[model samples]
Target chain A: MSKKDKSFEVLMGELETLVSTLEGEDLNLDDAIKHNEEALQLIKLCRERLDSARQKIDKLVQSADGEWQKQPLD
Target chain B: MAQLPELNNTLSVSQITGHIQHTLEQDYGNVWVKGEISNLTRHSSGHWYFSLKDSGAQLGSVMFSRQNQSVRVEITHGMEVTAHGRISVYAPQGRYQLIVDQMLPAGQGDLHLAFEALKKKLDGQGLFDPTRKQALPPYPDRVGIVTSPTGAAIRDMINILSRRFPLAELLLIPVKVQGEGAAAEIAHAIEIFNQRQDCQVLIIGRGGGSLEDLWAFNEEVVARAIAGSSIPIVSAVGHETDTTISDFVADRRAPTPSAAAELAVPDKIELDNRLSNLGQRLQKNILNRVERHEQRLNAIQGSYALKRPVLMINQASQRLDNMQDHSLRMVKEKIGNYGSKLDGFEQQVKALNPLSVLVRGFAVLSKPDGKIIRSVNQLKVGDQVQVRLSDGEVQSTIDSLNSKKK
Candidate 1:
């Protein structure tokens, strides 16, 4: 998969794993923290990708309007 | 009115009784009687024997097991009934009795009819829909109970609630649960509990009894009160088999008053175990975090960059030393070779000097006017000239000279 799609898949997988782990209530403190950290990173990456996509859409809109806009996606 | 004289060789007692029984059976065939049933007995063989009586007259009745099995309504003592049967005589005892085959209730009270009509009406309204019922709270903060203050249901509710979940507060709203105006009183109690806002769940019920005893709960007022309450209500009226209108309209239905209490709260032991498990999970998480950080720290400390701090510096220093030694040797060799060649060139230049040539026994001839003499024609007679020798110079005047030969 492309890097963006791969990241998205990883994020979704981590979310499912987190839900199952929390629901199962069998995780040790260590495992919970590790999973939590992984979930947080996945969330951050997903958010970043979403923000980038939003910026790209904004750029497309501005280009359609024939305007030179300097928008930085963070 | 017979006037015949009795003889010693007359008919036996059995024959005489059979004759009388046959006559009575033929005379009173297929009769209907209305009377109160008394001394009712149900034999193990499923037959019924009872006496149908008025204020003064009474008659024995027998319902065969086969015919009695078809009786839909319950036959009980003190119940007035109208029965259709054939009057027959038993030859063994010569007793005449009614052999009933069909029966009907002589009279039904107004209260019983009203109870049945209300029950049917409420049932048709879908008030007893199980899908509309709400689940009891797992842990109610406060439980409100509406019943008679002296009833057994309240006691059962309180006992079960306290034993199962002592943390829950019980709020009892004492009201008459039966008889006249009991329905209104129960409804008012429910309204009061709802308006107070302190109770999270409500239980409305009473002990089990006959239809009349539970008529209050069957009332429309009580059912509407339960349905209108904002709080979730659990109806536990009467026994498991007895149903009331309030039970149908309430958010939940319990088989008994004690069961309602059990449903309203959760077990404390189970909750405690859960909390402990969560605590353990938290600790494990913290320890795992620490271990991961320590592993990262060890990895960093063991990295090559830190272990060999002077590798780059040593290599650079050695290179600089080798370059200096190489440059020094090159310069020394070049300077030494160039110095010897320069000394030889200087010696040749000195040998070509005029003074050195004169020293080697060569002379430069010139006229007396200090000009070098190249030909005799250019020289004048008696011209003073200076001559330089290897070790000295001579002054002389030239005489006239001619060129004799080339």
Candidate 2:
């Protein structure tokens, strides 16, 4: 899938792999540090995604064009 | 004719009616009658009177306080009940009435025969089978709520979902949740949700109420709607004990509206906590790896070979250094021995050189025939002799030299 279309589950998989790569025995110190840095960035992004999420209520209202469009709920 | 002696005999009305009543009671001791109750009334004396009517006829029925006390249910309009009593006649009114002792509601316990029939039918079709139930998504992106917009249920659900997980979007499809046309509205809303793919799941219900108030959810249309929905539907029809047909046909049944909200999405806080736990594990793994590397470093640093690297190198180089001096002395000694032997050989070679005799001022004579005159007997007296010096040779006739004995 496209990067932007990646779900939280996909991102979680990536995060898990990154962490394991960092901890792997065959990994060199520089590569391990690099993987750890990338994992930390992913963790930060995931945390932000979770913390900043807000539920929005809306209704599917039929407009004059005979199409259902989203309108904010009261 | 055999006993006609009483042709002119006239009896009193009370005595004749008493005999008739006794005969009627003796003929029909007890009977059960089933019909719809109409024109029911409760008298001031705690007596219940009604008419049991069928399409063909109507029977006047009366349940006195003494007899009606045994009846479990009250006789009401349009209620078909099977009553147990006897047929009796009132002589004064000259009309027979049924004296009901016990009454049992017949069509159903409380007008739910249709409900049972529909449930049986739908169940026969496997609509309510557990296997047909869909598994709800663990993390729904959006949830559509098909309920009355003005109800506390929607408000409670919205509030619950928001508080539990704010990640999922809520799409409210407003509809009447009760009364006329409510079932159609509910079904329409579900259809819309399915048609538009509005949300991942649908939560359909109203607040708790009586069966009459909650009839819309019990409707066949609503049940069919729930069964046909492409999206998984969560029915939160009424209180926990109240199960509507919608609840039976739904993919999942939530006892309360707030519980449906809880079922529709994952709790973000729990997920966040899990993510944080994962992050900690990730860091712990890295720390463990780095600690292993550091331990290797400590091992190398504390090693004896590494601690005294110069000594380690010196031990290897000392073998080569000792061999270098030995090889150098052997080479010089062998060369000196060869040099003495070469001088002896040079002296022997010099003794064989004729040029050495010239340097010593010695001369040797030979005959012109290149023969040395070793003996006078071998030489002619007039032979010329040639004398050879170190630097030059003179050519002459050989003369007799002396014979020498060596």
Candidate 3:
């Protein structure tokens, strides 16, 4: 999934995986640099998401015709 | 009807009492009664003896420890209650009483009874089994809330959820929390959320209220919906002390609606700290790897193998110089020895010199043909000869022949 579409849970999971892989004893410098860059990017994305999040509230209402619709709650 | 009673056969009081006990116990094997509690006594043995009475009549009641252990509400004198039990006769006292198994406050006793009954039934069906409970997602993308739209419970939940984790969207299904169709609406909302599959977790709860006001949460329908939900649910009902059937059936239980919101999602501050830590660790690891590689590079550059060619050339030239010096020394020593040998040979040549003997007055003779006449027999008479002395030579002819003795 695109970075924007990935859930916070998935993003955090990927970040953790990268960090641990980089921490291993035998990884070459090239691979370590690559993983480090990717992990830092993920951290940036996660922080931005956490900082910019605004709780979106939606109220679900069923119409008289028996169809359910959702609208933003005030 | 056909046989006449033997009135003359007098019956003892115990016999009459036994008959009365059998009839009364058999007729009221199980019954429910509503009355004001009077003369309540909690005995040391943990049994409760009380009287259930109206103005006209009173019924003796005894609730054993085992049955009353599960009763959550407190019972006091003059409090109205609804009690369920079988009738039993005390033969020795000639009295019958209600052996109460359950009791609740009179006003909402029916709802409480229903709650207990549904709790027991669903528990027996293993709907509340820990194995059946699903794990809540660590990071919920959306939280489905089933509650009244305008209640304080929803407000509190929204406040807490927004403060802790705003990443999750709150999907609210506004429903009547109590009145007639509240249970059906709550159940339907839960089912709808499950069908949509949008919410990762659900919080079903309400603000604290009287038992009647919170009856919807205690309904069998709501409990069954929670049990059958594909999404894990956190049930928050009433206050910290109040518990509903929904709480027992849910995957998790929170004492209040705000607590349920907290349980539904993770806090962002903790995640932020963790992300920072991971970033630091990544940087450290990369730096360490680079430093190690650089150190290895430096060691390789300064290694002996890289400088070996020049060192080998220098060593070969030094060996060549040493060999040259050794050969020159050998040549000089040989020349000196040969020079002394040459001087000795010069002295020997002087000793054997005939020319030097001539200097001492030795004469030499030769025939006219330049052949030296070493014997007198070599010359014949009338042969010309030459005589050589140290300084002069003379030519002469032989006139007489002389024979020499052998």
Global lDDT scores for all candidate models: 0.73, 0.83, 0.90
Model 2 RMSD in angstroms: 15.4
Q: For each candidate, report its DockQ versus the true two-chain complex.
A: 0.02, 0.36, 0.63
Model 1 alpha-carbon miss at residue A26, Å: 17
Higher-scoring candidate on TM-score, 1 or 2:
2
- Total backbone collisions for each predicted model: 7, 8, 0
lDDT of 1 by residue, A21-73 (tens): 74455666567677766655555554454334311101101257755343321
TM value for model 1: 0.46
Put the candidates in lDDT order, highest first. Answer: 3, 2, 1
- Residue A73 deviation, candidate 2, in Å? 0.8
lDDT of 3 by residue, B311-391 (tens): 898999999999999899999889988988998998889768867778898878788789998887898889988878878
Give lDDT tens digits, candidate 1, residues B223-293: 77877788889888899987777877898888899888777765555544533454455456556656867
Task: For model 3, report the TM-score of its A chain.
Answer: 0.87
Model 1, position B211, has a per-residue lDDT of 66
Models sorted by DockQ, best on top: 3, 2, 1
Docking class of 1: incorrect
Per-residue CA lDDT of model 2 for B27-69, tens digit only, reads 7667767899999999999998899999999999998988787
Clashing pairs in 3: none
Ranking by TM-score: 3, 2, 1
Candidate 3: docking tier: medium
